[model samples]
Target chain A: MTSIINVSNLSKTYEGGFQALKSVNLEIKDGEIFALLGPNGAGKTTLISIICGLVNASEGSVTVGGFDIIRDYRQTRALIGLVPQELTTEAFETVRQNVSFTRGLFGKPKNPDLIEKILRDLSLWDKKDERIMNLSGGMKRRLLIAKALSHEPQILFLDEPTAGVDVELRKDMWNVVRDLQTSGVTIILTTHYIEEAEEMADRVGIITGGEIVLVEGKEALMNKLGSKQLTLDLLTPLEKIPESLIAHDLRLDNGGTNLVYTYDSKSDRTGITSLLNDLSANGVKFTDLKTNQSSLEDIFVDLVKQSS
Target chain B: MNLRAIKAIYLFEMSRTMRTLAQSLISPVVSTILYFVVFGSAIGSRIQEIDGVGYGTFIVPGLIMLTVLTQSMSNASFGIYFPRFIGTIYEVLSAPISHLEVIVGYVGAAATKSTILGLIILITAGFFVDLQIAHPFYMFLFLILTSVTFSLFGFIIGIWADNFEKLQIIPLLVITPLTFLGGSFYSVSMLPPFWQTVTLFNPILYLVSGFRWSFFENADVSVGVSLSMIALFLMICVLIVWWIFKTGYRLKD
Candidate 1:
């Protein structure tokens, strides 16, 4: 896939000498959901702000759809939509007015039909005439999304879109994001929720300490670092692991009623059969067995720990 | 020029004015009428005249100037400050519109509101006193200039201020005092000679004098100096606004 956004050697240092982003480079593929996962103050918002032209970078350059962000701000910004992390709407303005005004800000002519569709899609049609301040927090967030999508931008940046959202609203927002992706809009979102990144991202970029530590396809990254844990229910309680089972990465759990073996799932030799044979030989019998695969959360924690 | 963007911002701000008509329009007019009641009627009967114009009539331009200056600054400052406070400024900053267009939209709306308020007060002033305009065109010219100039000043204050208290500082502590001392209630010529020279240093004196001149064709300073001072101040404000946008000071991190 062709890249829609290109960033090279980007760095940002604020007035007080705090470096928020450092030599960070990234490329977002066209029409793909790319999740930027990072801890707070890891420069995720800073990165998004710079690309959206709300904040200036201290150094480096960024281009969206072959146009430099600074040199061609209008042209580049016209193609981008940003739903900021903060739930900020014109409190006194009606929902429809806020959305329509945002479209006009992009120099798009008034199109009530388009605005209506976006509002309906976001489930904000019923509340279109209500003042924003009167809406519930979830409804307000949806309004922000409607405003962002009012101009039908090619690229949408959702900064912590689901932050502070309830489970139902988060699920709704995820569906909204997925629907946008199906319509061929490239999405770049920053999130601390590992499950959100796991569920929505085609690719994941892990950032820490003002740097892009790793960027990889979600499936590939998981498989590369994923480990499987095989839990064996003991026929009888054991005080400790048998000497023969010591060679395997095994641990006793559940008050010695379970013996758990951990092994790389991607490895050619899991040695499950050999481990089973040794277990029987050592007089350790299992009544039942189950395996658990490591999740994206584990890998994320590992990456952050290693990088820091 | 992104006229659509400008119109969008302008309409949004204008609608806000409409929604708060009681505070934005009614309050100022009511206060000005009160001024005409106390100063125009009570003082006018006693003093009769100052600078050869009726006491009531002489203070009309100055009263309008007081309201115009304060209204322009407060309106424009609050116009931009609220967005920053609520974090909606991100939408405008991230939009395809240029900084100049953003300024034109906000400052233009503010100046329009203040100018309307000034004209409304002018019309209302006519009810209490026999007001005469020697130069109607210059009167309007001064009105527009003062509105636009101080609106720009307020825009700068909006960007510079980070809190509600900071936003009110310049208007209350600086602009309001300067306008009062700038001879809004009385003529500087009536003051002793030393004080007249001292009053010349007040920047608002030029705005008040220039506006008052357009009314009676009489002023403490030459019309040329007043006009030059206003034009120079306008240019300085424009330059400062340009610098703010160029450097992204307070607007960008």
Candidate 2:
């Protein structure tokens, strides 16, 4: 895969001595969905802003499609479509006009068919003649997507794309993104929703405090750090955990009716079979046993905590 | 700026402004009619003539300029400020349109609105008084120059403003007062020598005088000086706007 975006030693420092981004580097490949996960004010927006030419980077350099972002701004901007976190369509403008105007902004000749296709793809064709202010929030978000995609950009940046969106819109947007990916358009998405990252991202980059802590394949990150929980329901309630069973690092809950054990999923010995044998030997019998796999949420929380 | 992008922005901005037609065109016509009733009749009754022109006819250009300045400033500032207030500025800035294209598009729309209003006021003033145009060509020249200058000035205000209140600050405190005190109702010659000298500092004085010259045929100041001052003022405003766009001063960061 070819690299669509390359950042080297990128940092951003605002006035009055506030550092929004530290020295960081990242490479986003073409035709893949890359998710940047971070908490609020973690420089996700700032980084995206710099790449979009909305803000100037204080230090370092970035190139989009082999074009330096600052020097070759026109070409770079033409190559990239940005769906900012804000829902900022012209309120009084018809949806079709807004999308068409955006396409013309790139100096592209009028392409009514392309505009119609974009609006239809985003499910906004029905409201093509409606004013933007009359549309609901989800429709407005989709309109933003349509406007960004009107020029048929090679790469797209979605800054907090699904923030404050309904579940139906979220799912709908996921389908739209999946469609874009299938068409070979590279996507870089920043999201606070770990589930979104887990479901959509081919690779995940965890950023904390203006720095990228780790960038790895989604499954690899989970397998390296994800932990699983095993719960055993007791046949009868007990006062406390037995002294002999203290070596298992199990926690008793609900008046000792259940025992929960957490261990690394990647560990060679999960200790489940041995713990069950020991429990039987010690006369601590359970009527049932169940295991729950760790989710991406668990792995994300652990990564952010360790990095921070 | 790419001509295609600028043209697109220009068309878009114009459509947005036209959507508020009732408030844009009708409001000004109504207000101009009120000005004819209140200022032209009530004030004209007490005063007969100034500089050999009837009181009613003499105040026509100034009244038109007043409408032109205020309307242009309001339209331009609100047109851009609303997008920022609603967070649509990000969409505009992220587009392929250059800063210059954005400024020209918005300011051009504002100039169009104000020019149209000025023409309406001129026609409305004719209904109240038989005003004679001494130089129709110069009248068009001054009208266009004043509208463009104020439109650009309002563009700067739009970029600097952070909120709706900030957007109205210049129109309320600066543009309106300047028009009113800059001899919009009376000639600078009517004031004392010291005051007249001070009036020279009011930029709108040149626009008012320049516009009035085209109506009254002969005024205290030569038409050449008034037109020269207005032209120079427009050039300075254009330069500043260009610098603002080039630096990305308030609009970008």
Off by over 4 Å in 1: A229-269, A275-292
**Pairs of residues at least 3 apart in sequence or in different chains that clash in candidate 2:** none
Residue range with the least summed lDDT across 10 consecutive positions in model 1 chain B: B42-51
Model 1, chain B only, scores a TM-score of: 0.98
Residue pairs with colliding backbones in model 1 are: none
Tens digit per residue, CA lDDT, model 2, B67-174: 898888888877777877777777667666666777778888889889988998899888889988988998999898888888887887887888778888778888
> Chain A TM-scores, all candidates?
0.85, 0.83
lDDT of 1 by residue, B27-107 (tens): 888998999889888877899578789899999999999999999999999999899888999999999999889999999
Alpha carbon deviation, residue B175, candidate 2 (Å)? 2.5
lDDT string for model 2 (A108-226, tens) is 88899888888887778999999888999999999989988988899999999999899988988899899999999999999999889989999999888899988998879667546
Q: DockQ (Cα-based) per candidate?
A: 0.84, 0.52
Interface C-alpha RMSD per candidate, 1 decimal: 0.7, 1.6
lDDT by residue (tens digit), candidate 1, A127-147? 999999999989999999999
Error of 1 at B202 (Å): 1.0
